[model samples]
Target: MLRFKELVLTMQEFFYFALRAFATLPKAKRYWRDVLDQAFICGVESIPIVLVSSISIGALMSMEVGNLLEEFGAKTMLGRSTSNAVLRELGPLLMGLMLSARYGARNGAELGAMQISEQIDALRAFGTDPIAKLVMPRLLAALIMFVPLIALSDFAGLQTGALVAQYYHKLDPGIFWNSIYPRLLPMDFVVSFLKAPVFAIIITLVSSFNGFSARGGTAGVGRSTIKGIVASSGLVLVANFYVSKLVFDIMH
Candidate 1:
């Protein structure tokens, strides 16, 4: 019962914070410098890992898919199999988990540290809107950055899959392209992109909520970071299921 109550309170905090952040977005241009800075942290700093991991995942998936399809002498299906798995599910899911660890934890820790240091209180005393000045920029940055990151991940995964198919599976590149293009509908791409923004919302809000709610000084910051990542990671999985279902219904 206590656990349920705590969960409810956390959800309330997330929604309340998210609403305020969104409402403040119009005036966000005034915070452009901060937004751009956060964008660099979330988007630019994340690219190297996102690119390497995505391509590696795609290649690994291709080998697994090729092995499965080869059983029935359907090696050409490698492209469709790999692309479908990557785009519809694995790519976004994996990327979200990674961002949850990287960006989500970092956001939580940064804010928690500020709270412990009394910087948030100092800002409040100075008549500054901490949510607007700090949280909102990071939230907006996450939303903007996630789309491009996911797009890059999608492309990298597909291209690496194609390479794996050509080299490891001995499938002709033309056949691979045919398999991918013909099998994947336009909505597949759209749905994948749509998932990114929803996930971005999840990561930023959950992290910020934990940051805002932190207590107990330095130890509290550490705890908040852990709890925030765990919560964000779980929410990402749950959100993915519902978003994918919604996308499937709409596309169909």
Candidate 2:
């Protein structure tokens, strides 16, 4: 169809634009301000959301694990199951999804808007590395912040869940903690924590690329923003499955 051809062409152009953005970074200290903005602003602002989501995740997973194990008279193993799952997969994936939906889309839209407004072009006129200035810092910040957030989420979620399962669910806290905590080997946390950085790369890179590549006017920017979020979020889910499996396989 003619429409399909146009779609393909659009994507092809987008890649070229991304490459241009990549070329924007210069070899200097000028980019640090942008990186700091990403780290302290974008990355820091995302924390409260991450914490709240993590707590909910912990409580919910506890219920699921507790209910399932309780039926098997393995209620004490609730902590183990919950901990392993969070440390290995859920934590990074959830945080990435949240970031993509919240921050990723926002970044894309901001850049896209700038592009439409000709601000990016203005910077290019002045010989700036938009990629280094804009994209790289976001990517760096994401890589920096995401891993810690994942670990925090996993630990907090599991603990919160365990507590809920203990009193609210009439479960034995001592048994649950003892049985489950021991199973969360270093590898479990390491595997999930590792994925966060990879996701960070994916998120900032994809989003910033999408934003900078946005063409036309307001509609194009809006489209790019939505697509970036949706595509990045989907990538996170798919990536989680493959990466988690690969890590566990290697660990085991």
Superposed model 1: Cα runs more than 4 Å off? none
Most lDDT-accurate candidate: 1
Model 2 steric clash pairs: 24-129, 80-180
Q: What is the lDDT of candidate 1?
A: 0.91
Q: Which stretches of candidate 2 lie over 4 Å from their true place?
A: 1-28
- Report, for every candidate in turn, its global Cα lDDT versus the true structure: 0.91, 0.79
What digit string (tens of lDDT, one per residue) describes model 1 on residues 34-126? 999999999999998888879989999999989999999988788888888899888898889999999999999999999989999999999
Candidate 1, position 28, lDDT: 82
Residue 99 lDDT (model 2) = 91
> Candidate 1 — worst ten consecutive residues by lDDT sum?
182-191
RMSD of each: 1.2, 2.5
